[model samples]
Each structure stands twice: as structure tokens, then as C-alpha cells.
Target: MTTTILAIFALVYLGMILGGLPFLQLDRTGVALLGAIALISLDAVSLQDAVAAVHLPTVILLFSFMVVSAQMRLGGFYSWATRGMANLPVSPPWLLGLLILMSGALSAVFSNDIVCLAVAPILAEACIRRQLNPVPFLLGLACAANIGSAATLIGNPQNILIGQTLQLSFAGYLQQAMLPVLLGLAACWAIICWQSRGNWQSSAPLPATPQLRSSDEQALDRWQSLKGLAVAAALLGLFLFSPLPHEQLALTGAGLLLMSRKLHSARMLGLVDWEVLVLFAGLFVVNHALQGTGLPATAVAWLAAQGVQLSEPWTLFGATFVLSNIISNVPAVMLLLPVASHELAGSMLALVSTMAGNLLIVGSIANILVVDAAARHGIQIDWRRHARVGIPVTLATLLICAAIFALRL
Candidate 1:
């Protein structure tokens, strides 16, 4: 049973790293779901155990925010913001600064993935319309989103998980994370702007803008956008001050958003990324099953004996940076959750995992979403193109975060 579970874990994470199994039409979510099902089918974990393994609060919180993001997307809030920024009449560098600032700030409150998904294509079009190169702006969107998401526990899925599991204070985490996130956002803009110095316009004529069926392209509905913004603002207030459980409060906000008369429930709920939720559920069960086998504990003990204590902040930070790039941030955080019982553990995990996503296109779902959104708009951001900016920005941001976190400690 142990061996089988281990094998399943290995295969599933392998699929995560590669994005799929060779010759198989499975994505990371599918691979994870399959692994969970396999464990139940083989009696490695009982159905009840599998269900219990999933952290319900984390799932609910993630779902609620996705609904909120969907509401804003349907209201065409993101598209409005993108167009508004593009026409600001500022110089290219200043426009770039505003783009990074807007992307980072929005992502700090909403889901980073959703922010990138909604903004990327429209940004591509706006850049093309202005006869500016879209590559730096697109990369900036993903980087800023990732960096800014680190500022709040609710900003990204992984941070939500770390917060819930560790029961960290929302305000406290914010206080610890804000400086690093700001510094990282600034570093991202500088790096991208510098890399884009010689080429602000494509040599060839801009390809026809791909038809985007994104929520950003939806007609801007002021009332709906305001409604979403109001809810988001109120929720953030509750998060900062109220004693209510974050999940319950977030869920309540989602339900309120669902009650709108004009926006059909189906359209709002349809925008939820059920696949991402499934991925979280599947990984929870798989990781739980592996934990039951006692290998993780034994390995941690062994590492400690060898003077490699993972509970220490620096060790965990290094491991998180490496694993996040390998298996992506969510799963990497799951793997490291065992040793993350330190006082600073939650913030360290959140910072490293979130910032590391800029290392490669596969490093974070935000990066993938940005790339996918751009591709749909007929813009190509190959790995090399992304790496040129991603590598330096990642190193600079990680160093800044490490310095800030160290000071906090």
C-alpha cells in the first residue's frame, strides 16, 4: 500500500512538472484527480479519509473569491481598467509603471490568476493599438500579479491555503508581506523595462488581434463592477478586523454576489475554475495519504539529524523556491506544509512560493494564464522571451523578500 501510494504520488507530481503525461491527454488537474481516485479505488485511502483530507475552509475561500473575480470579469471591469490605463497619455515608461501598479494592486485583492486572465489579452490589444510591444507589458502583468499576490493572504490560492492551515493573522501577514511585495513589484517593472529598452515595437505589422471571448471584453457595466468592488472592499475590511472565520465571511460575500438580479447565477458560477478546485482537492488527498505512510516525518527527522532543519526560515525558503518551480507553487507548498510549523513559516512559504512563479512559465498558474491569454490573442510569449525577464525579476524579488522577511524575523 505504501509503495503504491508513493508511486501514485511520484507519477502525479511528474505530470505536474511536465504539465501532462506523454501520449496522454491529461492536464495537471486530471493527473491529480486520477491519483486521488486511484488511491480510493485501491483502498490505500478510504473514501471518508479522502474527503477528510481536503481542507474544506481553504476550498470554500478559494471558490468564493473565484466567484468574486468572475463577477468583476463578467462586469467587464478588467477590460475597462486596461483600456483606461492604455489611454492615459503618459510616456511609454510611465504607462508601463501604471500597468505594473494596477496589475499588482488588483491582484493583491483578487485572484492573481483571474487578474492575469482578464487583463492579458486586452493588454495585448491595447499595446498593439498604441504601436507598442506587448511582450514586456504582458510579462509585467504576470510578474506583478505574482508579486502583489504575496501582499495578502487571500491574494492567491497557495497563500489562502497557508493562512488557513497555519491560522495566521491576516493583518499580521499583510504587515510582513507588504514591503517585500512592493519591492518585488518595483523590481519587476525595472527589470522588464530594462530588458525591453531596444524593442518597444514589433518589426512586423501586428498580427490581427485574436478574437477574445474573455470577461474583460464584456461591455463595461458600472453598477456590476461597483457591486463587485464594494463586496471586495467590505470583505477585505472583515478580513482585517472581524473575528469571523475567513471562509465563512468569504462565502457569505460570494453568496451575496450571486443574488444579483441582472447577472444570472449560471454565468457567474460558470466562471469558477472548477479544475483548480479539483486540483487542490486531489493534491490534498494524495499528500495526506503519503503523510499517513510516515515517510515525510522520517525524512524531516533525518534532515534535522544531518543539521538541515527545515523548520528554520532560511532552509524552508530555499526548499520552497526550488520545489515551487519544479511542481508549481500549490503542490510545492503542500509538500512543505509538514515542516512549516515555525512562527515565520507561513509568510516565508507564501513569499517564496508566490515569487518563485516568475522563474518559469510553469512556475505559477498566473504565468500560465497570462501566457494562455496572450496566445489566444495571437501573441506568442515563448519560454525564452519570458525567461529573459522572468529570471532577473525572480532573483531580484526573491532577494528583496528574503531581506525583508529576515528583518521581520
Candidate 2:
């Protein structure tokens, strides 16, 4: 049974690393789900135990926020915000600064992926209209979203997982992360500005920008937007002052939004990223089963003996940086959560893992969304272009995070 569980676990993570097994229809979410089903089918874990292995708080928190982000998306808040940013009467560098600030701040509150999805195409069109190069601005969007999501525990999925699993304080984590995230965002603006020094004006003749469908573009619904903002603001207050479980409060907020007469529950629920929720569920079970097998503990012991310890913030940062890029942030956090013992471990994991997503094009969903979005308007941001900004920005932000963590220590 141990050997069988181990093989299943290995295969599942292999899928994570390669982004799915060759010639298989399964993606990461599918691979994770299948692994859990296999564990149950083979009696490696009982139905009850498999269910227990799942973390309800993390799952619920993620689902609830997805609904909130859906509400914002349907309200057309993102398009309104991004369009407003692009049309700002400012120079190109100032415009880059504003984009980073807006995207980062919005991402810190809502879903980073949703922010990218709604803003990317519209941003491309605006840039093309101005005859300004969109590549730097797009890169700014991806990098800022990743950095900003690290600002608060509720900002991103992995952060939510770490916060719930470690029982970290939302306000405390925010206090510690605020300075680093701010510095990271500044670094993002600087790098993009420096890199695009002479290229702010695209030399390529503006291609006719493709028109987005009416269904694709959402006009701002004032009432719905105000409603979503009220819920989000209220939740933030509750998260800070109330000692209640974050999932419970967020769930309540989601409920209130769903009861609105203007938006159908079906529409609100439809925007939820169910696949990611399933991915979290599947990983929870798989990781719990693996922990039961004692291999992870043994490996931690072995690494400790070799002068490498994950309990140390720096070591944990290094491990997270590599694993996040190799697989993905959520799964990587699941794997490393076992060795995370320091009080600052949760903060370290959340900040490092999130920032590392800016390193590669495949690192974050936000990056992929932005790149795909640019392609629609004849703006090709290939691996080389992404790497040029991604590598430097990632390194700079990680350095800022390390410095901050050191001061905290």
C-alpha cells in the first residue's frame, strides 16, 4: 500500500512538473483529481479519510473569493478601471507606474487572474490606439499582480492556503509584507521603465486592433460595482477586527452578493474557478496521504542532516523559489508546508512563492493571460521578451523580500 501510494504521488507531481503526462488529455487539475480517485479506488485511503484530508477552510475561502471576483468581473469594474488607467493624461513612464499601482492594488484585493483577464485585451487596445508599445505595460501588469497579491493573506490562493494551514494573522502578515510588496512594486515600475527607455513608442506600424465582442466587453454597472466594493470593504474590516474564521466571513459576503436582484446566482457561480478549487482538494488529499507514509518527514530529516533546513527563512525561500517555478505555487506550497516551522514561515512562503511567479511565462496564470491577450492584438511577447523583464523583476523582488524577512528576524 505504501509503495502504491508513493507511485501515485510521484506520477501526480510529475504531471505537475511537465504540465501533464505526455499524450494525455489531463491537465494539472485533472491529474490531481485522478490521483485522489486512484488513492480511494485502491483502498489506500478510505472514503471518510480522503474526505477528512481535504482542508475545508482553504477550499471555502478560495471558492468564496472566486464568487467575489466574479461579481466584480460581471460589474465590469476591471474594464472600467483599466480603461481609465490607460486613458490617464500622463507620459509613458508615468502610465506604466499607474498600471502597476492599479493592477497590483486590485489584485491584492481580488483574483489576480481575473484582473489580468479583464484588463489585458483592453489595455492592448488602448496602447495600440496611443501607438505606444504594449509589451512593457503588459509585463508590468503580470509582475505587479503577482507582487501585490503577496501583500495580504487573502490576496492569492497559495497565500490563502498558507494562512489557513499555518493560522497566521491577516493584519500581522500584512504589516510585515506591506513594505516588501511596496518595494517590489516600485522595482517593477523601475525595471520596466529602464528597459523600455527608448522603446515606449512602438516602431511597428499599428495593426488594426481586433474588435472584442459585445459579450466580451462589459460596461460598468454602477450599482453592481458599488455592491461588490461594499462587500469587499466590509470583509476587509471583518478580517481585521473580528476574530471569526475568514472563510466564514467571506462566505457570508459571497452569500450577500449572490442574493442581489440584478445578478443571477448562476452567473455569479459560473465565474468561480472550479478547476482550481478541485486542484486544491485533490492536492490536499494526495499530500495528506503522502505525509502519512512518513517519506516527507524522513526527507526533511535527511535535508537537515545535510546542512539544509527549510525551517530557516532563507532556506525556505530558496526551496519555494525553485519549486514554485518547477511546478506551480499552490502545489509547491502543499509540498513544503510540512517543513515550515518558523513563525515567519507563512509570510515567507506566501511572499516568495508569489513573487517567483514573475520569473517565467508559464509561472503564473496572470502571465499566460497577458501574453495570450497581447497576441490577439498582434503584440507577440514570446519567451525571450518575457524572460528579459521577468528574470530581472523576479530577482529584484525576491531580493527585496529577503531583505525584509531578514529585518523581521
Q: Which prediction has the highest TM-score against the true structure?
A: 2
Candidate 2 C-alpha RMSD relative to the actual structure: 1.0
Measured with C-alpha atoms, the lDDT of residue 65 in candidate 2 is 90
For model 2 the local lDDT of residue 262 reads 84
Which residue pairs in model 2 clash with each other?
none
Residue-level error in angstroms, candidate 2, position 401: 0.9
Candidate 2 regions exceeding 4 Å error are none
TM-score for candidate 2, please give it. Answer: 0.98
Candidate 1, 99-194: lDDT as tens digits: 999999999998898998888878888887888888888999999999999999989999999999999999999988888898888888888778
> Which regions of candidate 1 deviate over 4 angstroms?
209-216
- Which residue pairs does candidate 1 place in steric collision? none
